[model samples]
Target: MNRILATARVQLAAWPSTLGMPWLVLGGAFLVNLMVFALINTSNEDAHTGGLVTFYVVVLVAYVVTMTQYFPMILGMSVTRRTFYLATCLMALVQSLGYGAVLTVLELVESATGGWGVSLPFFGVEFLQQSNVLLQLLAYAVPTLLVSSLGMFFGVTFKRWGVIGMYTLAIASLVVFGGLAVLVTWLRWWGAIGAWFADQSSLALLAGWPALLTLVLAAVNFLMLRRATP
Candidate 1:
């Protein structure tokens, strides 16, 4: 437990760049988005903006780089794979929650200000707007975990197996998605699937699957880490 905390601290030591920079980028993008919308929003319709969504993409890239850049250094410093993996998960969880809380607060503020007087829906998507704070945090946090786990999984895969592994992973993903598409078409389940999704609450749609996928990816990341080199 102490070792895990220690390792997490090491990871957090770079928090300024890892965590702070992404929000900086998000803020800059948001300003630009707000300006664009303000100028063109003649209708004054509170439309959904894609600006904040890019934060998740930033997280994906950040975690991938985090793993690729630091894993070797941490391993060389005598941290075991299990310890490092646990620490990475801890760091990701904490970072996600922190970001989620801030986003939720900003969302609340946006609501109060009526989308900052521009009617731009930057943080408040109608589908994801939850009255429950906990659920809202979960919705925001779950995707961070999912994206981070994916980055970790791929980062380790690349570290352990190089370019060939990435190509294989990409190809495998394509095949799986293609197979699923074919299966859905053959079974005529597209409507049923869409209806099922429609039936589920936004919390279930956003948080539930992401939490499950995060677990799966985390497990895979740990397994790959077991065989990974510094």
Candidate 2:
């Protein structure tokens, strides 16, 4: 247990990229959107932008770096693969929760300030609005976990199999998704799929399904890392 925690601390040692970069990117996105939205002379009071996604993408990229760069270094230092994987998972959970709490608080502040006086709904977008604070936090955090796990998966694939592995994974994903798209088009199931998504509440859509997917990806990462070379 102590070893796992130590490995997590080792990962956190690179705090600039892991802890700082995402917020910096998010702040930049917010400022850019705020400026653009404030400049526009629209009478619509419910203006919203999807600029919040920048933070998540940045975090995902950071974790990919963790796997590609940090994992090999940590493993070379006598840490076990199991320890490294556990440490990564622990960091992911803590980071996701911390980020979620910050976002939730920001959303509350945005609501009170009338979207920073421009009625710009950046954090408190309509689709993610939740009356229950805990649910809202879960909604934000779950997707973070999902993306972090995905990044870890990519890193693990690279460590295990290199560039060829990444290309194979990408091609496999395209084939699977492309085939699924063709099947959906043939079956005319796009409407049903859209309806199914439309029927879900915000919490379920953002947190519930994503929580399941995160688990699957986390499990896959664990298994892959077990056999991964550095």
Candidate 3:
């Protein structure tokens, strides 16, 4: 347990990229959105931008770097693969919770201030609005976990199998999804799929299913890391 925590600290040692970059990216995106929205003369109170996605993208890329850059270095320093993986998971959970809370606060402020006084809903977007604070936090955090797990999975794949492994993974994913798309088209399941999504609440769609997927991806990432070369 101590070793795992130590490994997590080691990962956090690169604070600039690991802890700072996401917020920096998010701040930049927010500024851009604020400027653009302020400049527009539309009276649409429902106007919103997907700028929040920048934070998640930065997090995903940061975890990819964790596997590609930090993994090798940490292993060289005598950390076990299991320790590193656990540490990575711990960091993901902690960071997700922190980010979720921050986002929730931002959402509240945005709502109270009427979208920063511009009538723009950058943080409190309509689709994601939740009356329950915990649910709202989960909605934001779960996707972060899912994306971080995805990045870790990709990084471990590279470490385990190198460039060829990545290419193979990409090709396999395309084939599987492409095949599923073809099957769905043939079976005329598009309507059912759309209906299934429509049946789910925003929280369920954003947090529930993604939480399960994150668990699956985390398991797979650990397995891959077990066999991965530094």
Candidate 4:
């Protein structure tokens, strides 16, 4: 147990420089939240909806970037997969909770100030159970797991994290984003979080499925790493 946490701590400390990126990302996200509160013209409900969608997309992107940084680091490190995966998810969600709080407060302030009213995502176990929360989460997590797993595979295969990160990002961008845009354009999700979002009921029943899937992929990649050893 102690060793699991120790491994997580080591993963956290491994990148002293990338540590601040989350803070910077959160700060920028907060500012955008404030701006949407203050500047957006919201004379109608659709305007409000648009503003909220914008907020969702921005936060999603922030999570992806943060996850991108920490995900690969954890994947590449010599640590227990359980420790690495849980720690990264906890840290990422903690940061998301903070961002959500700031946005929630700003939304209230905007309403008070007669600006566009927006509701930030609430934090807590309740929020986690909301309709497609799992979907929303896995929307980000799917691509993350894929990229992180592939990155580890390539990094271990080639013995170079940077090269792997670069090429993987490029390929992932070309494929994932491209597919999503086309899909969402051709078939809108109504209130759904696009096709990438998983069903919460399904996800809840299959607790640890994400971690289980990630672990299996990681193990497969680890096997590759071992076999490639000279």
TM-score list, all predictions: 0.95, 0.97, 0.97, 0.41
- Tens-digit per-residue lDDT, 184-212, candidate 3: 99999999999999999999988989999
Which one is best on lDDT? Answer: 2
Clashing pairs in 2: none
Each prediction's whole-model lDDT (CA): 0.86, 0.91, 0.90, 0.47
Candidate 4: give the clashing pairs.
Answer: 135-198
lDDT per residue as tens, model 4, 96-184 = 44544554454445445554333332111223322444444543334334444444444444443455755875798899988987887
Q: Runs in model 4 with CA error above 4 Å? A: 14-20, 47-216, 225-230
RMSD of each: 1.4, 1.1, 1.1, 8.4
Model 2: how far is 230 from its true place, Å?
A: 1.3
TM-score of 3: 0.97
Question: Where is the poorest 10-residue window by lDDT in model 2?
Answer: 40-49
Q: Model 1, range 1-230, lDDT digits (tens) per residue?
A: 99999998888788888888779889998999889878986445645678877888888888888788899988888999899999999989998898889888988888898888878788887877887888888878888888889889879989889889999999999999999999999999999999998899898878998899889888888888899877
Candidate with more favorable, higher lDDT: 3 or 4? 3
Which is superior by lDDT, 1 or 3? 3
Better of 1 and 3 by TM-score: 3
